[model samples]
Target: MCTWFYAEKATLSPIITKAQQLPLTDTIMNTMARSAAMSGNIRPTDMAAVFAPNKQGNIAVFPMIWGFTVDASPKPLINCRIETADRKPVWKDSWFRRRCVIPASWYYEWGIPPSEVGYHNA
Candidate 1:
């Protein structure tokens, strides 16, 4: 989603620490190091460049073009249902190979009443 997400500083500490340990080429290391210095938190938009994939199935030392979130007329897609992801054209490819985890302390869900039931009281 284009809407900025919240990530706890505590949760990001370990990930940034580990990224620093990665054996990136001098160029890549320099870029990330600079960005990290400027911004206390690493932005996900810059991750593809820092942790790109290589032809040999290894992490590339250089950054690459990362997918960007778009602000469409409709609300941005914040969540995708795992069950229908494969069938959806926009997400099919990324779902298969470019999957990434979103760490969150909490999530939101909506409740809908059963259509068949006229009314139910507890």
Candidate 2:
């Protein structure tokens, strides 16, 4: 499972602004800039800018915590596989009802490092 993600404000900002028909406020832009700079990787518990439907069903930017918590584990659940999401107890409700779009360029997998696994840019 991937617990880390990356979002580029430069790419996300325009889409959000256009959707809302307004420029992103300075505060929101500054916050995103700082957060992205503080850690290139956005991990569980980190605040992230995500897109979700509002009451009117219009997409909007919102600050969201990166994961879901469960009693069975000390760490939060960051990823839910589609194959098991509906069948799994922990993800059942959210899978059916709650949803949000995370605008991430890419994510890192757990365990073995990419370099050790011989991954390289083409």
Candidate 3:
């Protein structure tokens, strides 16, 4: 049920570049800053840091779209329950092979109780 999160370029690049053992370049830094998504209500085309193996064995941080594309629909599925993923066909392969970690400073939640309405820590 996660629909929002906070991300900062400062954290994302290092997490990826370090994992892949890459030096930070000015171009990538600029791209990270420009594309930084620091909000929870992200859409399908939004980018996030995901890990993938490069030619070498080390994992590299890669920019990936938020969710899978759905045929004949504009909106995509952003969240799924992990408990049932193994039994679901759509996520079975990804659950086993394409597992990843998302670098988030925090997350946002709505409709919480009066004292916790605006935001919550991740």
Question: Per-candidate TM vs. native?
Answer: 0.40, 0.63, 0.58
Ordering by lDDT: 2, 3, 1
Candidate 2 achieves a global lDDT of: 0.63
Candidate lDDT (C-alpha), each: 0.43, 0.63, 0.56
Instruction: Mark the regions of model 2 whose C-alpha exceeds 4 Å error after superposition.
Output: 15-39, 71-74, 110-122
Best by lDDT: 2
lDDT of 3 by residue, 40-68 (tens): 44434565666676668677676565676
lDDT of candidate 1 over 1-122, digit per residue (tens): 23233334354555445544555524554664444321122233434223445678776334332233545524335456789889887678777787444433222233322122232343
Of 1 and 2, the candidate ahead on lDDT is 2
Candidate 1 C-alpha error for residue 34, in Å? 8.0
Q: RMSD, model 3, all Cα superposed?
A: 6.3
Could you give the C-alpha RMSD of every candidate to the true structure, in order shown? 11.3, 6.2, 6.3
Q: What's the lDDT of the predicted structure labeled candidate 1?
A: 0.43
Cα lDDT of model 2 by residue, 48-78, tens digit: 6678888898987766667898889988876
Candidate of highest TM-score: 2
